[model samples]
Target: MSFATPLYLCGPLREPRQMLADQQYSGHTSIHDDSMAEKLGFRAGPIEGPTHFSLFVPLLAEIWGQAWFERGCFSSHFQNMVVEGELVRAFVERPAPGTTRVRAWAEKADGTPVLEASASLGPDDGATLLDERMAKLRAPEKLVILSGLYVGMLGAEDEKVRMDAEQHMGDLYPFSLAQKLEGITENSPWYSDAASTPWGRAVIPLEMVSVLAEYTSKQAAFPVKQPVIGLFADQEIRMIDGPLFVGEDYLIRREIVALSESKRTESYWVRSRIYDASGETLKAEMLLNHATLKHSYADYEAEASA
Candidate 1:
């Protein structure tokens, strides 16, 4: 692919209401749940991190082509959260030719940073943003929510996950793509129409990819018994063999990568590998930092005080 070609000459497109998935799991009112978010001081539950990822698809496809879906890596560190109906836009500051990576970011019209990321097509594309971050991650200390999880802890067994056409996404993601789009603040055709592209089927949006790649997390429960609510502190999705088509089956294996803590929460990193149904060809991967709020776990307070 040529370097100078502009994916969006018109500049960033307005990203509209993206809040959809309701994370009612822990009942503590996470940013994913509207009522919970409002009570927690946010305007409304802020849109999920993975949902913001969809903003970059068109730009990636424009710069990398179909090959990108096979081996592209998008690594990001979330900077801030925006609630439903907030105006934001994705931008790619394309790299000068002969370079392997480019900087990407999203900002509200008022210029608040949303998330900053790096995108590249590779295995040879060099290290992704998450790769570098993971390399520097310090082992977590004095953890309560993620107490038993150690590096390299494996899942109980391999998991096979897929998205059904009827909007059923299985346990990890209770809502389907159709349902998500219903209240979608940003309406994009690329998410629903297969005929819009040369690909025979509709493309799976990153929001769906988030579910497609890790819906079976419970099968590999890492022994963290705390009922504390968890959220993605940071996440990276890397595609190896394809774009991860909709309604296709993929197998995944998870391992605890690292554990770390912040002032208010403790986090565990899980590295999940996605494979085609044949179980041989690797297709995609996700690196997730599941950060649990210490304030939400009563046990954490007791342990800290003791």
Candidate 2:
């Protein structure tokens, strides 16, 4: 809770897994599938970018204690693909006294950058990495793959989501919170032992915040052309009120806040707001850039020529 910290904090090297080989969406196998990844020019199915978020939690928690979970933010832009078995580590640029924001990142063992990020504690009004990026987005001149999508589009329904220790998260995340704890990069008793937590309830892990928010995302049904491949090009997860708890019910409302394109992909940004079970209290928020690969869309060339 104090700033008498070192210049930086380094975490143990971890090998995050690619558990999405069977991930399906838009009626097709996703980029996390080995065959799909090869067709799209990646060396292999890369680990989901947010998996790296776990490596930084222990370090940040040490710096800010339990508050890091209640009102902390981790904003990141993934820089390189990390296939399974590759070693990666997290680093935080220790903040000076009274500072709330600090730089954070991850890298492969040989020093290849995996992702670059910002970590901060709230009541924060500070701009995150995605906040800056979204601000600079000039409306893409043309969007072929994401043409069906528009900014401010809302999810089809309010989703009620929660993570139970033994419940499998569904196709996109195919594992339970209990299963994740078995191999998590940094394990904490607070994740499973309510008796040991300050909140008196077992809290969900930092990285699993992504899982909790995304658990029922398909209900949102923001219409993007599908059967095409996509990946997490960027992400920001923030806790507003406090730590999200395991087995606790929450409601999520989503909206497409922005859209853009590059030569290889078209991206739609969605912001999911998590509310307490009664749908009244704001608890956490996640901003994500779901970028769809252009070439992977069967109609990209055909539709462009038309």
Candidate 3:
């Protein structure tokens, strides 16, 4: 809870780029676009939250070593939106000599908090940041944008997904792995040189792993009110038998695990399981909280009043 010093580790300040300015979803420009963000009340398009995950890799890796890539988990709750050109740095609390979990956070140079998180190495069984958040969730008194969604709902199909260096990730992402690497906050040969990594394959960057899982998310068809703006409220990514590799075949299956609401938004929690091409070997998992802004739905008021 406290982020005071002796900071176990701190990353260099970095200006993460806004690669999602051109991103589109639900047949409209997403909140990551400057125009859409302004219309939605944000000063400018904010860089995707996960883009900052790369900044913590070096710091975490230093603590857990190669095991960090194989079985580490990062669970986060977004605290503030960050636009391009803002300087941000990552920090990790120094853990007791044998503790598996530690507090982590990112902050802008001006002292505004960006996110608060928990980082841990496997085989960890303790509560993560999202675990704590999910535990305290109160069911919504009403549902509008996400009325049709419910817990335990499964994806429409088993999606076969893969990330290749040059393969564009579709409208939602609007970029390729190669393009992301060009401006990545951190870099390593393991991301590009197959022969250079201990796994003997090119591994996808931490942030790109988020992109890969979401690349074909639409195909899952967990129907909700359309054209509503949403943003990630909380997230957790766990590497099971990972570092997921580039140019490798993988399959993803999604399920709606929970739904809740706030004064201004309705949220649905989705858990995605990534597996080997055969769908038998579990590789990684991602749990995302997508919070849809109530005002963005054209009929939110009308439906509520009715």
TM for every model, in the order presented, reads: 0.88, 0.96, 0.97
Error of 1 at 28 (Å): 6.5
- Global lDDT scores for all candidate models: 0.74, 0.89, 0.92
Candidate 3 per-residue C-alpha lDDT over 1-306 given as tens digits, one digit per residue, 9 for 90 to 100: 875556568988999999998888888998899998898888998899999899999988988889899999999999999999999999998777677889999999998999999999877648899999999999888898888988999999999999999999999998899999999999999999999999999999988889999999999998899889999989899999989999999999999988999998999999999999999999999999999999999999999878
- lDDT per residue, candidate 2, 1-306, as tens digits? 655546889998889877778887767788888988898888888888988999999889888887898899999999999998999999999877678999999999999999999999888648888888889988998888888888888999999999999999988887899988988878889999999999999999878999898889989987777678889999999999979999999999999999988878899999999999999999999999999888888888888778
As a whole number from 0 to 100, the lDDT of residue 180 in candidate 3 is 90
Q: Who wins the TM-score comparison?
A: 3
- Best candidate, lDDT: 3
Clashing pairs in 2: 70-242
Q: Model 1 compared with the native: what TM-score?
A: 0.88
Model 1 bad stretches (over 4 Å):
1-15, 18-21, 26-29, 38-43, 170-172, 181-199
